[model samples]
Target chain A: MSSTNNQDFLPRSQKWLQISGWLLPFLYVLIVAALYGAFLYAPRERVMGEVQRIFYFHLGSAWNCFLAFFAVALAGVLYLVTRNEFWDHVAAASAEIGIVFATIVLATGSIWARPIWNTWWPWGDPRVTTMLVLWLIYVAYLILRSSLPDGEKKFKLCAVFGIIGFLDVPIVWMSIRWWRTIHPVVIASSGGGLAPKMVHALMIAVPAFTVLYLTALLLRTAMHLHQGVARELNQAVLERGRP
Target chain B: MRSLKLIWILAEKDLRLEYRSRQAFLTTFFFALLILVVFQFAFDPGSTALREAAPGVLWTALLFPGVIQLNRSFQLEKEEGTLHGILLSPVERSLLFSGKFLANWVFLVAIDLLIVVAFVIFFNFSFEAKLAWILLLILLASAGFSAVGTLFAAMVSGIRTREVLLPILLFPIIVPTILAAVNGTQEVLLRHQPQFLVRWIQLLSAFDIIFLAVAFIVFDYVLDE
Candidate 1:
């Protein structure tokens, strides 16, 4: 429903979507293959056995969560400077996908942690708690948008929240470091946790998950842009009817 | 000089109003106190290990009261339609922000001091070493929190669900300051080495400056329309 007025920008956004859609399947297949190689083929850990296989995917997802929030911070600065809707869309889209990835990270980390650390939840670990907090914050972002009526106010409010949320990253990192310092490190030895084959399997799995993450983000943004177009047109029609 | 004068006058007006009604402070303090009591029950107080949890408990107490006080700070302006009147004034709108943030910071800090003392008594935590350093960090962190808080409260003041929305928006960002303050205070209570507390204090100062400058700039934009 977009007009030709912004054809240049609109088409690129559509193209990104198309390309992302094409990439998702290829990326998923690559990840599945990598997981297969890592789990079944890779030499099992002497200590963790089958469960060490989850580490590669879990680490990859955690890496993606950090990247997502990093993008969000950049989006915040750009939105502050330009006041453009495009960057806001990018931020909102990234945050949504980031939350999804973070959820996977949390779940998979727990699964991995249980077999190795012998605990489902590890308290005072900075990374885990920070990601959870970040997940909650962005989830609150969605809730916030729903609570506000549609208008400029919603945009500005979300933008401010986006910028402010950047402060949490460093805090989370530091809190973890401090927490680690306070707790006595009783388990220093992994006891020959990873074999060469297992490490090789993880290398393949890492990038696969990252590519899948980027693909999902691009696809989500494309659909969001389409919806924005539909909304503006509806508002235009409603305004035209009033006069 | 005149603008400074205006800032003070507005701040004094706010303080006087709060002094007369006292509801804002009363409710905010009560809210904080109630949360503190709740946290005591939420955890096992009989255990000696509970003392280390003091910082976390202090932060939770401060967080809710901070939001409640922020929401009420602008309620008077909204009720009297004085916000619009103030907007019409030639006073640099940022001054209005300065006034509001100052008053909020002052009131919150007062409430914080009481809570910290209560926290010490309840937890039996020692605050013997580096008392001044800890107080400075707390005040700086309070300034950082209330500065952004004042800006957001104004931004959402026009919205229907501002009451809930402010905390939703404020808490995520405020976590860092809470981290610094709580960590720094923990160091003091534990009598950590001076060098360690210095680093946390430095972080608090950096946070204060960055957020204050941000709110100062962005506040003008928010107030304009």
Candidate 2:
């Protein structure tokens, strides 16, 4: 495990660790500031009241969720072009974090919807349904990754899926939007313009969540790289021990 | 022109194999029939509620059995080791995707017609001129379904959990197809809404083009060993 070849892996892994080490304290402060911005800084909604506070985090997570999935597709394209395993790690890590943010988006959206929309799950809302479908697609991507053994085949196949999944998103949203508009359900419109103060809170919360997503993506990707190196070392040890 | 012939030859090869055995064909049709029967029993058959829900039932029957066919499309190739032989040949990867997709689309459309007939009978949809619209919906929707399905089936062919994994990987991405298909069927059969049906058909056609192109481009990676 400690061979000279293994030594080459160390610095790369440590570089990521060192970067995250510096970023972690900043992430902590940013998150605290974000929570403050959400709970106390943003003005309470006149209509939805205190529960509407969830919007800041929800909107932030929603923004980053789409961004994360875009990263997955971008990484997939890079991996295909370069055949570099690093992009696969980026794809995988982005997908995992994307699912987390999507879950937050759905959960927060659902919680907010209960009082405002008068339903926990609004099937009539295109954006809501689109997010749900997006969540399911990436969840399937992760499942496909788990089912396959680790190799070029796994990376290549996952990259293909990531690209296809992202491409499907816009069409899914459009179709659902059309479906909902035709049916014309009676849900309240969520579209009124936001106040300037509320926008300021969102600006803070969005960057805070964005930073958090980056930190998680970096850490998870570094861990995947470490796992790859460990597997190679383990294989070498087993082969040397045999016969 | 020669490329088209090559693609047709590849598709014809799979079609000929299936035509010879007819195993997947019979089983897939029977499975689709069973789904319709199961739905009939689950719902109050011949009731107003059942009429309302028939479009959902029809598409569900159509969608689920198609997965079986998709899985088998590559499973047969993998089992016979023909995939390796095909890969060894100097065929373009995109052409290979089109050929496999064409075979799957043809198989799906054929079986989907039978399932639609069975659906009409079980759900009490009349044999009318509007049924032609249903047929068109089947053609467009199956094109999109098979495009994505062929790519994914090739992807999961080597994995152990492919049977379960294929649908999990497939259904979400194909939600637009399902929504459009079911709603289009409803517009034709229940509502008599030609204008709305046109919109649904447009969605299906758009989905078909987008996914077919995507699957064609990305298929090179799925088969890269």
The top-ranked prediction according to TM-score is 2
Q: For all candidates listed, what's the TM-score of chain B alone?
A: 0.94, 0.98
Quality class of the docking in candidate 1, CAPRI style = acceptable
Per-residue lDDT, model 1, residue A182, is 51
Give the alpha carbon lDDT tens digit for every residue of A1-243 in model 1: 233322335787878988897997889788888978777878766666778777777777888887887777678678768766676678778888788888998898777767677778665566666777787777877777677765555666677666667665676566556545555653343534566777777677877877977897788777767777777777789989995
Q: Using Cα atoms with residue i matched to residue i, what is each candidate's TM-score against the true structure?
A: 0.86, 0.96
Pairs with backbone N, CA or C atoms under 3 Å apart (clashes), candidate 2: none
lDDT of 1 by residue, B173-201 (tens): 67667777777777777657667677777
Model 1, position A30, has a per-residue lDDT of: 85
List iRMS (one decimal) for every candidate: 2.5, 0.8
**Model 1's A-chain: what TM-score?**
0.86
Model-by-model DockQ, in order:
0.46, 0.89
**Residue B9 shift from truth in candidate 1, angstroms:** 3.8
